[model samples]
Target chain A: MTGFDFPPPVMPPGVEALRAEVRAFLAQSQAEEGWRPDSDFGSDWSASFSRALGARGWIGMTWPAAYGGHERSALERYVVIEELLAAGAPVYAHWVADRQSGPLLLRFGSEAQRRAILPRIAAGGCYFAIGMSEPDSGSDLASVRTRAVRSGDGWRIDGTKVWTSNAHRSHYMIALCRTGPAGESRHEGLSQFLIDLEGDGVEVNPIVNLAGKHDFNECVFDGVTIPADRLIGREGDGWRQVTGELALERSGPERILSTFHLLAALVEAAGPAPEPRLAEAIGRLVAEFYALRAMSLAVAGRLEAGALPDVEAAIVKDMGTRFEAEVAETLRRAVPLEPVAGDRDGAGGNAPSLASALGASVLGLPSFTLRGGTNEILRSIIARGLGVR
Target chain B: MSDETLRLIEQTADDLFAAESGAARAALAKGEWPEGAWQAFAATGLAQAALPEDAGGAGLAAGLAVLRAAGRHAAPLPVAETMMATLLCHAAGMEAPPGPLALSTTAAGEDGDGSTVRRVPWARFASAVAVVGPEGTLTLRTPADVVEGANLAGEPRDDMALSGPPAAAGTLPPDTDGTLLMALARAAQLRGAMEQALAMTVRYASEREQFGRPLARFQAIQHHLAEIAGEAAASGAAVDAAAEARTPFAFAAAKARASQAAGTIARLAHQVHGAIGYTAEHDLHHWTKRLWAWRDECGNEAHWWRVLGTDAGQGGGAALWPMLVAAGTAGTDAAAAAGEGARP
Candidate 1:
């Protein structure tokens, strides 16, 4: 009578074998490519590796077979992505497409859109960027001022999208723009347009991050025309479509396991002969990690059963991002090493590769809470879901 | 395991809990045994809820449901303790005693190497005490000395000193560790209490208004409610996982996570409800106080965190994930089912 009815998580049968299979593939790939495990998987891009995973039917795994998908269960998809994130796979190339765009297209795009783009996504040959966040509207997504007015048999879009990850490299952008006037409710009158990054009058400017990465971008659309078929769902439906899309974007093992490589590296660095203090910190992190995993996995389980666990997903992100940030905090107190600037070659400074991993995580901490909806915005969303607002 | 069966258990427990909790609270506040309350609870067969079906017990899942229901109402029924006591009695082939039960699970500190566990729940009121001492697992029928103490919720958590050894009568199974069982029981109670707090907070936010609107309409207030929701949601999920699985790892993690949520949930619920939630007449403190007490009772967050953390930490990062995934796992298929389905 009084509780959030989160069904206890139970993955599909034999996910461990799938787990082992993934672990083996990651190890083999890491060995063959001589790449170090990265702390942030979603931020790091690799076209070859994304293609490799796609070839294995690991990307877009849950879609129907007609769309070049493996038609596996959501649980199976959960297992693969969790493994990919845990091992710090360079999944950025296909991360956005595989995570939300493909699903959105399948659910709301026209048959023509699905046929044209879904297979490319399934093949990991395409990349996409979320255009929900603008320079003016971060968490206040409904306040997006980007306009897409009517044109001859198409629409002309003019807006600037900020903090758009992978926008420069992405093939398309699912931009939420205003097609109509903002009425009494701010949520109404918005529409989602599929904008091509290569279209005329489109400019992508690099927004360098604290971590010295060029993944984040600011894209300006100047009267770029997109055909009517590019509209996702219907007119005046972008708010609902994007809200659901945000849920898909925010939830996932990625949010929780983004900094997992650092935690894993901490365990390895501490070794079996850890001091009491070190041991306690390790133990604490592990316990919390398991609990967070249980909660996150429950969300996935609910998703698989055809329920949208938006609040549950928000909880995961809120708790999960804090935990992700805590890894660095825990490392600082538990271990004794000043975080020197990490070189790309894993050398120069005497800091362990673990230190470099920690360094990378620390530099990206600000974005962890900011990117997938700010923490404050997430709390408001959670509150609304609780029927409080 | 059918929906009807679980529904029956939930409805019956909720009804009994609602009916008896006020009277039970009066007796508990006076530090007296609520005989009528215990009888009403026992009448539901929750005392034997965790016993195997063939043993005339309702099984673990049903027992947890009963505990959760009692916890939601703050019924002071000792549902978890009674079920555990009955299971132990049934296992050891002893006649189980009637009335209020208690369990002492904490290990004796290094200060005095005595065979005892301090702060045993309901020790003064218990007919018998199920204990895991330095000697071995045993239940003392008559406690020699009980230094009276109460947790933050006013429930008796007396320090029962065991003067003599076990009766040498029925010995508990070797596999039983009182501390772990206590963790499981306390976590279940915390889960129930948090649910009550969440429900109360939501209702209060929806009804109480300021500035010509319900408190729920305020963005800041909604944020606080959301915080509590997140805590309660995570705590509930973890506790359910522990209850359904009943593994050492699962139980430990559940206790740690639930305990961790307690501090924030109690604080924010009070914050959202404003000053009114602090009063004794409001009934909000009842659940929050219980959450405070139960979180630190069997094993606090720190205790269980270390329990899970050390084992997992020693395994290093590579082994940690597998260990977690393997927590409630049995052999191949059951593990996979737990992987793919619910508790095996």
Candidate 2:
């Protein structure tokens, strides 16, 4: 009824303190370790970088204490993630685990699975790769042919998952597989299994991205055995589980901050006195950025109150991703200087900031729109929410 | 005006328009003026919503509220134009048009026959056309419909063939006020069209698919669609800021932003709709066509930008920041003023 009058995103009383702690930790880490912040590494996967964050009890901050979590609010976790992303800290190592896997296990995983996996996630020692997209199953996730036949005490998984980000480095993966025959509903007969990447019969083959980096992999799960308890939630509920996971995945600061580093770089390159056009563009961008941040916080607030905020989340993601892409473009057109030796190579090499960010951003941009759900899907949700449809 | 009064005005207009115009369908089909609809709106005190309270109208700042409802339903009646005319008349200390009158305006021009006025569009549908002459005098005339060309909305244009006893005309100084008001009205129409286009595309995307997943699942599609959302939101904010400013410059910026956004959005909507969007059978074209016409109607993007650019240049380069701050802070009330100093 008013200006974003929803519940405040659930956060502990000390969440601001937690943010201050993370900021101090990052500042110290940058000073001591002399880490070179790379825009190309949108999310860092450095083992050392992750363990340092874990040491401060920042990783898996929202899970129960018994599972090595600090048992904080989701908003507190959101604050930490926002700070980490803004600082461009290398956080890819435990990102998936902290973001969704740890929470997923706590919710639907068996006791043995939670006990075995979550503590490592909180300690930042474990990593997880999503095994949803296959070679032929890019957007058509329901058509995945990856199958797991029931064995004596476990299931034998034999299929290849393509575009599996960080599969080579991840300790384990939660793969969606067909455990039953194809039925009337394509969404039916699907189940998710937590497979150990280091286990026997599992192969992690590198798939080089367009940037010539091994950020993704083609994992072959040939006769990979997972114990009966490895299945997440009830059988045939994979669709519902994945949908819930997306609500978490899509409704975060990540959606808007993808091009944040580029913005910083552009500002730095522009110097204190910007050209009139450039200044105006930056000012407009900043206004939209603030509005989006408020919108995202509102969604986070909704989710913290045990509400889905599905349509609102979609709106945030939609607006956020566009702003990200636009920032990259705006910087490309505004700045005239090239990166001096150490900067990453982007497309065309003319505008490296745009190129480097755009290279990852363009490839990654598709997923931003399509990943959690397409913009079109989100709009439909918004339309329904507004009662216009 | 208070929120309750605004709500009441919106509800009354929405109800009367729905009943008299039958949700814009009858107007869209017959191209006949909804005289009854106009009378109902006048009865509800919306015909002069922006006039002074002493005038025979509600005298409330109901611009945004009225625009939102009109945009939602794509109502074709000239509510915004009528309100603008009423405001201008009140500002000039002239008696406002009364009893279901459609008011139109045009820029000043020279004509030996005392007929041609510069830059007048949609002059045929007006009961009376107002023209600002070369001497800066505003002249009102009731003219024949031959001068107004065919309008996209199917309504008769308001172009007037002027030939009458020269009536005394009011004068407005060289400022952006009149142009700004016209631009705001057009921007409101564009805003409505943008919302409709977004809704149409989203529906199409959900029901249609190419590679198993809904077309909405493709990242490329989502990215384009997301851009549309961003544009719409930005334009909405800009329009609101302009309306709240009640100044020529702010409204000029809003008009420029809204016009550009509407054009881009319309093109993208058609792109997302693909071949189906181009067809007449689909109602998507109705909104898209209106967007194209509206963007170029009151003032095109190029014209407004040139005006804004000239104004900024003339005001000196340093004035840009303060102007921007003023524009951003235009819409906030007193309670929201704490952070006002922190804006730019």
Using DockQ as the measure, the top candidate is 1
- Worst 10 contiguous positions by lDDT, candidate 1 chain B: B335-344
Candidate 1's residue-wise lDDT over A1-389, tens digit each?
44466666666787879989999999899878756566476656889988898888898899988888888888889888888887777788898899899999989999888889989998889999999888898878889999999899999988899989888888999999998888889988999988888765579999988777888889888878888888999999998899889889888988888888778777777787667667668767776777777787788888888878887888889988998988888886677766654575456422346556667777888888987788888888787776666
The residue-by-residue lDDT of candidate 2 on B166-220, one tens digit each, is 3436764433244456667767767766777777776777778797877776656
What are the per-candidate TM-scores when only chain A is compared?
Answer: 0.95, 0.88
Index of the highest-TM-score prediction: 1
Clashing pairs in 1: A11-B339, A11-B340, A12-B340, A283-B309
Tell me how far the alpha carbon of residue B154 in candidate 2 is from the true structure, in angstroms, after superposition.
9.2
The 10-residue segment of model 1 chain A with minimum total lDDT is: A345-354
State which candidate has the highest lDDT: 1
Give chain B TM-scores in order.
0.90, 0.82
| Candidate 1: residue B108 lDDT (0-100) | 25
